[model samples]
Target: MRILLAEDDVSQAESIKAWLEMDGYSVDWVERGDHAILAIEQHQYDCLLLDRGLPKATGDDILTHLRKHQHNTPVIFITAQDSIQDRVGGLDLGANDYLVKPFSLDELSARVRAQLRTQHKGTSQILMFGSVSLDPQAKVVKLNSEIVNLTAKEYQILYKLMQHPERVVTREQLEESLYAWGDEIESNAVEVYIYQIRKKIGSTMIKTIRGLGYRMNLDQT
Candidate 1:
């Protein structure tokens, strides 16, 4: 999952970034609320972790602006204020969850998982297409009753495909999901991965749309 973290404290931001990255989340850090707004406008994020106190703009201000602009992306406010009024105010401003500072990393991780689960309407962790199942949290894929070992790129490609089964997924969409910022992508990189997936699973699983792209034939048995 992708996350945008807006925290001004350098050390605290770095620590949270490292922990989240270790948990297999792609995170972009911005030190100011304005930058956070810009980042949200630019990229699609599963969630946003915004500090209540920010430079130039406060987190509540950002939340109000986002809601005004119809951006319903789930947001969790991280603040040093532990007062009941502060927490209630943040939630009323459209924040999905509030975390007070001096919090445990375990609790933070749990909150993140809870928010994602609720935001996706309980569709964030596990994805099922026909008999194929993918556990995003565990980064595990299973076909029928057997566990299938997949490389990083392979898992990402498969996850993207399974996320929207029975629909055509163009090559460009797959490319964006696989490569990061400035990573080089070969012309047939996605095709090579598709071939690998078919070899591991079954050629009948992923159906090509001729000149279009590919789709998982989930209805087939």
Candidate 2:
């Protein structure tokens, strides 16, 4: 999954980014709320971890703007604002969850999971297509009951494909999911990952569209 963190505190942002990355999420961070807005416009994120006291644009402003434009991406406010009214105000502003600072990393992780679960409500977290199966929580993919070893990026690509079986997933979308700000992307990076995935899971499983992108081959038996 991909996440955008809008936090100005350098040390705290680094720690949060590292922790989320370790949990199998690709995270992009911005120190200013305007930069966060630009990132939001540029990429699709699974969630947003926002600090209320952001520079340039406040978290409340961003949240209000997103809701005004009907952007339903899940957002969690991670701020030092700890008053009851503050929590109530944040929730009223459309934040799905709120975390006061000095919170445990474990709890933060759990809250993120909870919001994701709510976002994907009624959809099984374990994705299945044909003979392949993926467990997002476990970060494991299996083919015909056998484990398939995959790098983090490889798993992310496959996960994207599996999420939309038999539907075209654009190359740009896949690239966005795999890379964060300032991460170097080779021209053929998506193709390389696709090549590696096919080698491990079987080539016929993913199909390339001549003028578009790629899709999971649901007819692959």
Candidate 3:
């Protein structure tokens, strides 16, 4: 999953970004609230980790603005404030979860998982699409009980497709999900990766929608 982290502290942001990437999440870091807002406007992120204090705007202001505009992306407030009033205010302002400073990376990861599970309405860690099963937490894929080894990009593409089975995903959408900002993408990169995935798995699993884009067949098993 892709996440946006808005933290002004350079060292803390780098540490958190590294930890989340190690846990198999593609993350984008922003040092200011305006940049965070711009990132949200440009990209579709699974979640947001907003520090309460920001350079351009406070985290509460960002959350309030997002809600006013009907952007319901889940947010977890990460700040030094650990008081009851602060926590209650955050929740009241539509934050999903709140984590104080000096928090464990493992705890942050667990909270992220909990929020994603709630957002997706999934009770299990395994995501099953036909004969293919993906363990998002573990970053593992299995096909018909046999483990299917996949490169990071291949797994990313497949994960994006499986996340929205039966819906045609445009090449631009796939590319955005697979790449971070300023990353160079070759022409026909999506097609190349798609071909490689089909060769590794099965061609019938992912269907090309002629001129539209690509979609996974819901009946594949």
Task: List, residue by residue over 128-212, the lDDT tens digit for candidate 3.
Answer: 8888898876678998888999888889899888877878999998888877665588989999989998887787888988888
Q: Which lDDT tens digits does candidate 2 get at residues 1-221?
A: 89999999999999999999898788999999999898888788989999999999999989998889889999999999999999999999999999999889899999999888788776658898888999876668999999999999999999888987878999998998998877789999999999999999998999998679999976784
TM-score of 3: 0.82
lDDT of candidates 1 onward, in order: 0.84, 0.91, 0.87
Better of 1 and 3 by TM-score: 3
Model 2 scores a TM of 0.88
- The C-alpha TM-scores of every prediction are 0.79, 0.88, 0.82
Find the 10 residues in a row with the least total lDDT in model 2.
Answer: 116-125
- Which candidate number maximizes lDDT? 2
Give lDDT for model 3: 0.87
Per TM-score, the best of the predicted structures is 2
lDDT (Cα) of model 1: 0.84
